[model samples]
Target: MGDKANCNCHTGNAVYGLGLIGAAIYFISQATSFIMGVLGFVKALFWPAFLVYEAFSYFAV
Candidate 1:
């Protein structure tokens, strides 16, 4: 007998990927320079953190 653990993480990954793409597009579109575009891509990678921080801030009041 084999014990297999079932995991369902693909949906979360898909959502995160979509959010990253959307954030990258919005950030890059507003950037005026190549460096800012690069920064935007970096920022997109941390979008979840920013979202959490903003949510906490909004609710902290």
Candidate 2:
């Protein structure tokens, strides 16, 4: 009766997801003040925007 589906893929996905979440938490905590910390967390949630902006700024210079 050992016909159960293997969960290796699910386990791998959970590990990857947790790692990304930990990185996001670290990114959000880099701010020194209450307001900035909150803003940083929001920024982390939408980090692609910041990435694009930084890319543009770097290229524009």
Model 2 steric clash pairs: none
TM-score of each: 0.84, 0.47
lDDT of 1 by residue, 29-53 (tens): 9999999999999999999999999
Candidate models: Cα lDDT each: 0.93, 0.70
For 3-48, candidate 2 gives per-residue lDDT tens digits of 4554345776676567557657886678788888787666656665
Candidate 2 lowest-lDDT run of ten: 1-10
Candidate 1 wrong stretches, greater than 4 Å: 1-9
Candidate 2 total steric clashes: 0
RMSD of each: 2.3, 5.8
The runs of at least 3 residues in candidate 2 whose Cα sits more than 4 Å from the true structure, single-residue gaps closed, are 1-23
